[model samples]
Target chain A: DAGVTQSPTHLIKTRGQQVTLRCSPISGHKSVSWYQQVLGQGPQFIFQYYEKEERGRGNFPDRFSARQFPNYSSELNVNALLLGDSALYLCASSLSTGEGYTFGSGTRLTVV
Target chain B: ELKVEQNPLFLSMQEGKNYTIYCNYSTTSDRLYWYRQDPGKSLESLFVLLSNGAVKQEGRLMASLDTKARLSTLHITAAVHDLSATYFCAVSWATSYGKLTFGQGTILTVHP
Candidate 1:
């Protein structure tokens, strides 16, 4: 079975610009979560959606937002991008809230 | 706030050596996860430790969790060049749904 998949393997944006990264969870998965991984660091949680409802949010600023579709696909939106926003955006999916997660290939965003 | 910390942020070891990566969390969690990520790639799930004293292994990699101590460890046995990558540990509290706090990754370089 195909694992979680993300779109636009790479992206480039300028300061103050906005970008949206998309993810499609594995088949039959009901939970999706987003994470940001900067160079030389671990991924930081951004948001999580389960059953089309917002379940948790991370320490990210309001400029970052996300939503899940009825089919369990997800989108992570970042506004007013800063150079610091350049990182690999990862999407993970799982069977349920407390289960092990499967991650996507991630979209590498480069903010100029 | 929940936090996960990893030790030996970077490790370079000779092939066939054994090493352990440690992960500690600030609060009790129901599940701990170990993931491997190659440079410029997405994450691959390695092990999922679900309860206190839980231990799981795959090939030459093994992971164990100590919930009471809020600690987890990923042990590499006879490391190989193919194991060169970054290892991350994440934790999710019982009430959390798809929200994971990740430790700063430990970059492992296995030299042949």
Candidate 2:
């Protein structure tokens, strides 16, 4: 079975631009969550969606947003990107609560 | 807010040596996960520990969780250069099904 898959292995955008990163959860998985990992730092929780509903959100600014589709795929959108926005955006999927998670290779975003 | 911390953020040891990485969380969590990441790569799930006194082992890595103390440890035995990578521990609470707060990550370098 395929694990969680993220799109556009890498991306580059300038400040104040908008970007959208996509993720396809593993088959049979229903929950999707997003995280941001900066250089030399661990990933920070961004948003989590289960059953197409926003379950929780991190401390990120309003410019960052995400949504899940009926098929369990997810998309993370960042508007007005800043240099700090350059980071690896990871997508994780799980079967149920506390059931462990499978992560994607992540989309490396570079905001110049 | 949930806070996850890892001690000895950087560890350098010789091959065939044994070492342990520690993870501590501030909030109550019954589920803890360990993940490994190579340079310029995505996270690979290593272990998922649930409940107190839970222990799991794979290859040269052994992980144990203690819910009462909110601590988890990953021990590497007979380490090799292949084990050189960053290890992260994530904690999940009941309220959020699949949302995880990750630790700072321990970068391990095994020398020959």
Candidate 3:
């Protein structure tokens, strides 16, 4: 069975630009969450969605937003990207809340 | 809010050695997860501890959770080069179900 999938694998953007990263959860999964991992650090939670509704948000700023679709897929959007936004954005999927999760390979965003 | 921390942020061990990584959380969540990530890859779930005294093992790795003490541990036996990676322990958010607070990660390097 295919695990969580994300694309594009890597991305590059200029400062003050906008970028969108996409994630397709595993079949039968209904919860999706986003995380940002900077170099030399562990991932920090961003947002979580269940059944197409926003459920939880992390300490990220208003420039970061995400939404889940009916199919349980999710999209993470970052507006006015800054050099500090360059990191691996990971998407994780689970059958429900407080369940085991599977993560995608993640989208590596580098802002110049 | 929950705070998760892992000790000894980095480890280097020779093959055939044994080591243990500790994870501590500030809150009273009963679930914890372990993950491994390569240099440029997303996280791979290693173990999930659901309750106090829960223990799970795979290959040369074992994980246990102690809810009373609010701690989890990952133990490695007979480590090999393939075991080199960053390991993270994450605690489940009680209210958000799928939301997780991750530890700082322990980078393990096993050499022959």
- Among these predictions, the greatest DockQ belongs to 1
**Which stretches in model 1 have alpha-carbon errors above 4 Å?**
none
Model 3 residue B69 distance off true place after TM-score fit, in angstroms: 1.1
At residue B70, give the lDDT of candidate 3.
Answer: 93
lDDT of 3 by residue, B30-49 (tens): 57999999999999999988
Docking quality (DockQ) for each candidate: 0.90, 0.84, 0.89
Candidate 3 — which residues are off by over 4 angstroms? none
Clashing residue pairs for model 2: none
Question: Which consecutive 10 residues in model 1 chain A have the weakest lDDT in total?
Answer: A39-48
Candidate 2 at residue B21, lDDT?
98
Clashing pairs in 3: none
Residue B31 C-alpha lDDT in model 2: 85
lDDT per residue (tens digit) for residues A22-67 in model 2: 9999999888999999999999989989889898998999999999
